[model samples]
Target: MDLNSSSPQTIPVVSTFSSPFDQSPPVKDPNSASTRKPISLWPGMYHSPVTTALWEARSKIFEGLLDPPKDAPPQSELLTKTPSQSRTTILYNFSSDYILREQYRDPWNEVRIGKLLEDLDALAGTISVKHCSDDDSTTRPLLLVTASVDKIVLKKPISVDIDLKIVGAVIWVGRSSIEIQLDVIQPAKEESDDSEPVALTANFIFVARDSKTGKAAPVNRLSPETELEKFLFEEAEGRSNLRKRKRVGDRKEFENGEVNQLEALLAEGRIFCDMPALADRDSILLKDTCLENSLICQPQQRNIHGRIFGGFLMHRAFELAFSTAYTFAGLVPCFLEVDHVDFLRPVDVGDFLRFKSCVLYTELENPDQPLINVEVAAHVTRPEIRSSEVSNTFYFTFTLRPEAKATRNGFKIRKVVPATEEEARRILDRMDADA
Candidate 1:
């Protein structure tokens, strides 16, 4: 269903309870929070039985967004393609109870950034599927998976019970890749207020795959008619080029002599070039700042593919980064941006995922305005095979809150001292060339 023609007033919100399989309950109060359903998700299209049931249970409300509006004018045709094939937007207003969940409901009834990441991933997936489905004529929709979260900026913390709007649009398209931009919006409290506050903005890249071959599939080419759309298309194109270059460089370094060089350096007990000296370690490096978190992927966190959710993994990494940053700066660190996240492999339900995070680099030219760079690596250990594989790597940047910066005195940014030459090379490779 195309939402380009939908009207806000006539659309009935999600009425089904939060569970995946439960039927819609009778409304006692028309204006209650339970009655104001969140956005509807696509129910039955692909994936396993349990996954389908879960999606169906969670997706009943998303269809309401396609309902026609009662107060707005006709759908504009200037920005996108035809109403049926054009871009779409979904509006969701999750309640505090729904967001806080059972475990997080105790003292702090705040929404977790992990939950927001889950929603962001889902939103981007939905947009990619819809964009690809425009030209698909088969019964099965085109399958697409998230390749990477190129960049994301969380401007402010999202609280529980607030009405948040997620806007998704296709900015650029490649032969099999699509770049999606998502904006997390916080509507103004006062009706008279004209400002629409954006809490977060993200750029996600997805790859289309052939159903039978499981290989890259061609997608529809995007035509940007508007100037803003054209600009985003160019930007996405450039980012895509950079991504390709980095991947090629990494592959070459790993295949060539870089890995061996690092290993040899480690064996020789020599330090890497352009690194801080061992004598300065006491003053620059903090002793207890690094952190590690471990957890088994439960059934609840599994997505339609019976694999652990990417957003859940990202959330775990983010929490680790935040904690490490807080420990280093002795302040309430605010989320600045996610520089990059590469999903190396899918984590299974029973896999033991370990998140190792440390403050990789810090810039403290001005104590009041401190910046931190953290690197979080995810490794999954399979119990059956007694083996572990690298799963994901996340690079994050954060800043301390203004009030904390103002009152702090002894806080300092610590530099990571690589324990080995391989570790040093990893640190060097992790640095963003663009930065």
Candidate 2:
């Protein structure tokens, strides 16, 4: 092979380009160093923490529930408050999700109202408050009496549905009165009819983080849903399209009829609603109660140079476990014990950690008790992705007591088989080992 091109006979030498007298290579354009292209940037506005949370709940409910978009709440109910000043702010703060118009409407087709009351039954003890107002001012000292939406008005003209997240709330507070103002985008209708289309308004209820303490208070009801509630179909009997037993008592015709009910039920390949699209009151899927927990830090949680706090991470991990256990057990599931919370390595802030739990085993340890066993896990992504080290794991055991057992009986149970992947198989293996 002539692969030895460097051999003296095959190669040629150029003396002109020799070292000593070699002039420097010509300079390339400094600014035109390389081909230029426009920088790519994600478009549109960025959502604030509040907007993110608001949209999270909104998207969650709408994804798989019947939530109406045209009803409005009554104003009288919107202004209602709890006797306690602490709850007043919480309830008022959570009462709006901006406004949701009809799919093809604007400004006023529906309104959203809310009550965090469903979850508040548990947080009374944790939330510090005092009853200052008289009974005449409002109804009770605890539960909020406000409606989710405060108004609604439908017009002959229609437009697109408007959904905006409510964030950055300012509660105008007095001794007994509080007016909460939330950041929202109010959509306007194109054509203004003399009838004045003004129905769609809405709100959201959430656990407000106390500004001074930075702690989330007990459950508080806010957001008036009267607007949407009024529009929901309360009675579907006569309103449904279920066939009305045509040609009753015709024996000869009945033989040939064979009751085309099945045929009527099966049209156009899609499952038809027997009635107009109806909203279910339970479709607003905000959790009624969340477990008591916080973020913590410790030695094993140290990230870089032992600068990370493990207690802080543990607090968050506990919260994840608590939330999982609470959602599944519902009501007030006790945080009995956090077992073998191994702090393998230091964890620092900014490392994304995931805490999860599922009903591993529910055994009636006693004839009169529902001693449920929850398998909890808290793990962090490899903090130093380059190092491939310092991942943390935390585990726990939670108990569902009788007082709140009734409430959590309906926590969602996932329906899936074991995964076939290596990591998934490891999880399965770990679970089996624990078993």
lDDT of 2 by residue, 339-418 (tens): 33334443555555555554443434353444434444445555556433434444444555455545544543221121
| lDDT for residue 52 in candidate 2, whole number 0-100 | 23
Clashes of 2: 63
- Clashing residue pairs in candidate 1 (N, C-alpha, C atoms within 3 angstroms): 6-69, 7-68, 7-69, 20-57, 40-61, 40-62
Q: 75-172 in candidate 1: lDDT tens per residue?
A: 12212232124354454434433532432222244446655676677667766665665431212334577888998988766655554556668889
* Each candidate structure's count of clashing pairs: 6, 63
Note each model's CA RMSD in angstroms: 9.1, 28.9
- Give the Cα lDDT of each candidate: 0.62, 0.30
How many clashing pairs in candidate 1? 6
Q: Flag regions of model 1 displaced more than 4 Å.
A: 1-21, 24-86, 92-111, 134-138, 156-162, 187-192, 250-278, 281-288
In model 2, the worst 10-residue window by lDDT is: 37-46
